[model samples]
Target: MSGAAALSRPRWSRLLLAGLLVLGLTACASTKGPGSPGQKLDPWESWNRKVFNFNESVDEAVLKPVATAYSEVVPSPVRQGVDNFFGNVGDAWSAVNLFLQGRFKIGVQQTMRFAVNSTLGFAGVLDIASEAGLERHSEDLGKTFGRWGTGTGAYVVWPFFGPSSVRDSFALPFDRLASPALVLEGGNSKAAIIALQTINARANFLRAGEMLDGIALDKYTFIRDAYLTKRRSFEDDDEEDDYEVLTPETPANPQADR
Candidate 1:
């Protein structure tokens, strides 16, 4: 085969993959079935189940073991510091999204949290902002879009990323772009940072995963319900009540339908 033809093959494959994702999203949005806690949000359950199984296999074979080893080898303080560092980075992005969502006061609070943590918390190795009564309001572009009246189209699961809605899936690229870790110079450095972040996150969830495994008859359903519930809570307008009212123009409360 010609070199150009060979190169075109990979491009075609990527296009095919993108087409499949778009098709899946369309199906998920249009298909309606009987409503259950899990089924209510997951119209694409069969595909999601297959993806979930794939994720489970990957996790059991790779992530679970690595995370287990990391948790055992690393000290709790060090792990907490790693988490805090990433969270501090996230706060900067969150503040931007909060402002975009027309939440100025909370946005300012998040900005303060990031500044305090980055400096006073020793480059975010400690969470000094929480101690100072500055709450962490984690926001992302997906949540910002939801606040702007974009609907949560459908629940879907990606290969390694796991559970996400159509809206969140679209926002994933922007989220990645917003990540401070990706700003590192070398590819190796970026990969290492991402891997550490992933491992640390998984390690933090180890106990919760074990508890879920022990109690839930259908683990997939339990996780799906829990994820949907949590995402829905983030989109809920009632959460605005938790924040102090800033201004009439920039209302603390966002719209409920997301």
Candidate 2:
């Protein structure tokens, strides 16, 4: 097991331990940037960074190793094919969301095309992404919410999950419950399929570890910046537009009628 994987043991799941870790390591456990909890920086940004570090420590110890092991057990070609298939399905969701944002009808159509081609043309043997009129477009829930005028709120690092903004974090519950893997949850013959998919996701990301390992400075900052930038790229609207918050004082007073 890698050094990070060992430290992610869940025995440290106690709330007290988590709280103490966050408070005590606020200084050392942060990114090198100005917006960290210990730096007296931007309050929201700092809070997010602190949370990110705490979460990263957890993922490094547990998820990374498990994912690494899963990678080793699967055949490379099969893993790649399965990954592409999943991406094809995921593209459908992205397309619908992109259309909802009114930005890139071509993206929506292409994503759906990928889904169809991967399902039909490839005979499940490959993704057939290139064969169909499809292309890759990366985006996630945080960016979608940002485009809709949702504030990023505070940064939080969830154990075993890693960095998330407050707005982005709430979406996790729905995302996990609705993921394709959950399709196997209710049936009796699903155990094998679910296990296989899990392994495939892990096995396919072997290069990810090397990429992560190559980071020279604070891992927290690297992750946070990457996440934020990627999220922003998905948003099609001007996020900085002034939003009107409903206040009681601004409401039409019934007393004015009297």
Q: Note the clash tally of each candidate.
A: 0, 5
- Give one digit per residue, the lDDT tens place, for model 1 in 20-81: 44543454446565565346557788999999999999999999999999999999999999
Q: lDDT of each model, Cα atoms only?
A: 0.77, 0.53
Provide the lowest-lDDT 10-residue window in model 2.
242-251
CA shift of 10, model 2, Å: 40
User: Residue-wise lDDT of candidate 2 within 106-193, one digit each (tens)?
Assistant: 5566566755665675733565666664555544554555555444444456655565655567556654443465665566546665
Question: Which candidate's lDDT is highest?
Answer: 1
Q: How far is candidate 2 from the true structure (C-alpha RMSD, Å)?
A: 13.7
Tell me model 2's lDDT, rounded to 2 decimals.
0.53
Deviation in angstroms for 159 in model 1? 0.5
Candidate 1 global TM-score: 0.80
How well does candidate 2 score on lDDT at residue 4?
A: 73
